[model samples]
Target: FQFCSTRHELGSIILTTNLDFDKWPDVFGDARMTEALIDRLTHRADIHVMNGESYRFRQTLELRKRVAKEN
Candidate 1:
């Protein structure tokens, strides 16, 4: 929170999270602080939401198939 507060408009910040904004409070454990942090971070930010199958999951499935074939 301090970092974001300090750099709110002075620099650029790139953040990526699998969790949604609504779920952030669960991680931060403080609803007010979470809201304030998000507000500061997103005040002038461009947001993007990506939805697709995970690459790691696909690779894991392929590895399992290969192991099954070997057995």
Candidate 2:
């Protein structure tokens, strides 16, 4: 209810989600919540699925090399 009602009233949102639509119900809890939420957002949203090796891990190695250069 909260998820659906707010977006309907406000008309826009920014959400960062790691799961695809098939997995939405797991987070939202049930079909009704998932259904209603998807209904509202689907019409106006742009889904961006980001895929690749994690930048967090890549950056850690890069940072280590930079620190070694400094030493």
Candidate 3:
């Protein structure tokens, strides 16, 4: 929180997480802290919620199917 509060304006940061803003407290284990952290992080951020199965998992299944066909 300290780094973000001080350095957020210095540059952009990229983060990936499955949890929504409302669920952040579950991960942080502190509602107040999560609120503060979210406030700072979202102040100048582009929030994108990605939905569905992970790309890597889908690709792995495709690879396995192809290998099975060849064998």
**What would the per-residue lDDT of candidate 3 be over residues 1-71, giving only the tens digit for each residue?**
77877777788777788778899898879999889888888986889887889999999999999999999
- Candidates by lDDT, descending order: 1, 3, 2
Please identify which of the two predictions, 2 or 3, would achieve the higher TM-score against the true structure.
Answer: 3
Q: Per-residue lDDT for 44 in model 1?
A: 80
lDDT of 1 by residue, 15-54 (tens): 9999999999999999999999999989888999989989
lDDT (Cα atoms) of all candidates against the true structure: 0.95, 0.81, 0.85
lDDT of 3 at 17: 81
**Distance from true location, Cα of 19 in model 2, Å:** 0.9
| Alpha-carbon lDDT of model 1 | 0.95
lDDT score for candidate 2 against the true structure:
0.81
From the highest TM-score down, the ranking of the candidates is: 1, 3, 2
Note the residue pairs that clash in candidate 3: none
TM-score per candidate: 0.87, 0.66, 0.77
The alpha-carbon root-mean-square deviation between model 2 and the true structure, to one decimal in Å, is 2.7
Q: What's the residue-level lDDT of 11 in candidate 1?
A: 90
lDDT of 2 at 24: 90
The segments of candidate 1 whose C-alpha lies over 4 angstroms from its true place after superposition are none
